[model samples]
Every structure is written in structure tokens, then in C-alpha cells.
Target: SLVPLLKGLKPKWRDSLYYHYFEFPSYHMVAKHFGIRTSRYKLIRFYQFDEWEFYDLEQDPDELSNRYGDPKHAKTIAGLKRQLDGLRTAYKDNSDVRAMPIEWRKKYRPGRE
Candidate 1:
């Protein structure tokens, strides 16, 4: 269902290696195959100015909880990080945008100074 929907949403042509590999079913497919139902996909998110968050998709579909720094969900966070890392490696995505220097953002957002 969502697999076909996601595949259909993909662009016909992806010019970048990373983008191209994303076309192949991976994490999303694996999750779907396992029937890991969540109210929303990509529910765990980190914002530029805010911390990470996690949603009890079955309850709070809107993801209003900041479970990032919560000690209770340490295992969940670690597991998710491991899963994300595995997916990245499986896809051969080596980009370190998250590890980029803070100064780099200043270059793009000159007004932030």
C-alpha cells in the first residue's frame, strides 16, 4: 500500500547517486514488510532550533513529545540510531551533512549573524 504509493511518488529520473539509490525499497520497505505501523512515517525528527522528538504514533499522531533527551527512551533512541546508520550504510550514503561545521551554516545564512 504505502510501498507502492511511495514508489509512485518517486521521480522518474534521479540525477544524484544517493537520490538514485533511494529509489530502491529499503528501510521503508523493511518497515512495511514487518507491519510496523505508525501513524506517520519519519515521525522522529530534529529541527534546526529544537531538539529531537518521538511520537507514540498510536496515540499522538502529531508527534508533540520531545523524547530525544528523555532517559526512559534511551534504548529506543539508540536502536533508531543504529537502524538509521545501517540504512545509510546499506544505501552507501556517505554524506555527512549532519557533521558539517557550524561555520558552514553561517555561510548559507548570513543574516543569522
Candidate 2:
């Protein structure tokens, strides 16, 4: 089941610690969800709800509040979104991602498509 890695290919192994998923079954539901995490942040997007939730580990260590849509975190949020897009592209996890591209996801609102 391991591609690019055979019985003795242990040394070339790489870590998939940065990977994230569409939360299968949950992704097909009325409210689709996709999440991504890096060392300093965690971002979750609720597709049907057009909501985004993100936390900054450096500032809010307790995660008591989400900084998403907060003006202070705009740049950070954009950067994270780009990373998430790259991950999804590399993994080819979903076929319809282009319909809801990362750029559109960033601009989406509850009232808008």
C-alpha cells in the first residue's frame, strides 16, 4: 500500500505531519468541512455555512477565541489559505475543488456563493 516505498526504502521515508483532509462523509453532508494545521495555526472551513475558524497558537495559546475574519489576522489567514490550497492540490483529495477554489473560499460569505 506504500507507494515509492518498498520493503527496504525506509531511509527515504517522509513525514506527512502537515496533511489534512475533507472529513469524509462529513464533507459530503450539507455542511462540508475541511481543516488544515501548521505549527503556529489551525484553520477550519465550513463550506455550506461559509464560515472560517482559525486560531493563532502564539497569541491565543488557550484557543479561547477564533481570530478568523479579524482584521489583525488577514495576512496570516491568506497565507494559510494558500498553503491549504497547495496541500489539496498535491493530494488530489477532491475532484470538485476547482468549483470552490481557495480564492473563492477566501471571499465567500454566508449570503454569497
Candidate 3:
């Protein structure tokens, strides 16, 4: 791991990181989404909402702009998606958010119609 590299040995580094947040009726009103991030880019899919977001970490580090449908980055986004799928399979994450237990809904998202 990074320990080997830190100790003056070679350690193979990964090219990307995968992230998933799947809390519906979220405490902070954040949508459920999954994403993959590399050193230079990040791609997110808000599956339940049918939305996709992408960012160029180099140019838009704040993620102020979404480049998902931008023609110039189509190829890059496609490659990232493939890598994301691979990560999902490797991690055995189905990328589906199961329903929260009813009691949790009452605790976390109470008083909603």
C-alpha cells in the first residue's frame, strides 16, 4: 500500500477513486449519487433523479460547471464511465440504493407528507 511507497519502495498506485452516497430523503437534502474521480476528472450519476454531472478537476476544481453533455469531453467522460463500471464490479456494489427502514425515515425525515 502507500506505506511501501512512503518507506522508499515502489507501490503501484491506483488511477481513480469511487464514491457513492445513497441516502434518500436525505438529512441534508442531498440526492443519492455515485461517482468516480480521477486526478483530473469526476463523474457523478444521480440515478434516482436521472441526472449526470461531470467536472474537470483541473479546470473546474470547484465543480462549478458540469461537463456531462459537453461535446469536447465526450470521449473522456465515456472512458471514465467504463472505469466506473469496472470499479462497481470490483467492489461488488450494485449501485442500487435499498429503501431505508421505516423507523429510520421517521427519525431522519419526520413530518413530511
Candidate 4:
């Protein structure tokens, strides 16, 4: 946790962070996605849409361009994908939609008809 760092304990710095967002195209029309952020790169995966995005923070801080399948960043993307999987396993996030509350499914899920 950041508590140690916040308390001035000089904890080892973290090189990356993991995030998962499960909000469908509900209120803001933002799709559900997950990502990992490092100091130099950010990778996002929109699972339901089968889409992926990667960005070089130094070059594209605004995240306008996607480098997910770029040949130049192939190795980097592979490494990030590995790290993403590790993070998911560590956090025990199986990405199971059944874990969401029924009401939440009815309200936030994109299609319910």
C-alpha cells in the first residue's frame, strides 16, 4: 500500500500499476476496459470489444495514437501483456461478470433487452 510511502518510510518504488474499469457504455458511453500504467507506457485492453491500446507516454502523453499492434513495439507490448496477466493473477481478478451484482448488471450493462 501507499501508506508506507505516505508515512515517509522510504518504501521501494513501484514501477507500474494495474487498473480495471467495468463501466459499460452507460452514463458517459465509455466502454469497459482495463489497463496497466508505467512511467513510460500505458496499455489498455477493452475485452468485450476485443480491442487493445498502447501508448508511449513520453511521445504521446495525450494518448491520441495507438501502438498496440505496431511492429516496433512488439516486444514491449508482449512484456506489458505478461505483466498485465501477472497483475490480474496477483489481484485474483478473473474478469467474471457474474461477480457483479444483478442490479448493477441490469443498470450498467450495455444491452438488456
Q: Residue-wise lDDT of candidate 4 within 10-106, one digit each (tens)?
A: 8777799999998776788776888899999999986655568999999999999998889999999999999999999999998852334556555
Residue pairs in collision within model 4: none
lDDT of 1 by residue, 19-109 (tens): 1112213544311111112223222422221224554555556657645576876776666656555555777766432422457435543
Candidate 3 segments whose C-alpha is farther than 4 A from its true place: 1-3, 97-113
RMSD of 2: 7.1
lDDT of 3: 0.83
The alpha-carbon deviation from the true structure for residue 88 of candidate 2, after best TM-score superposition, in angstroms, is 0.5
Tens digits of lDDT, candidate 3, 1-113? 47786899977779899988867665677778899999999999876555689999899999999989999999999999999999989999975655455675556446731
Model 3, total clashes: 0
Q: List pairs with backbone clashes in candidate 2.
A: none
> What are the Cα lDDT values of the candidates?
0.42, 0.66, 0.83, 0.83
- Report lDDT (Cα) of residue 107, candidate 2: 53
TM-score winner: 3
Per residue, candidate 2 scores C-alpha lDDT tens digits across 26-108 of: 54533456767767787877754456789997788787798997999899789888877877777786644323555554454
Cα displacement (Å) at residue 88, model 1: 0.5
TM-scores, each model vs. reference: 0.44, 0.57, 0.78, 0.77
Q: Who is ahead in TM-score, 2 or 4? A: 4
For candidate 4, what is the TM-score? 0.77
Worst 10 residues of 2 by lDDT: 12-21
Each prediction's number of clashing residue pairs: 0, 0, 0, 0
Overall local distance difference test of candidate 4:
0.83
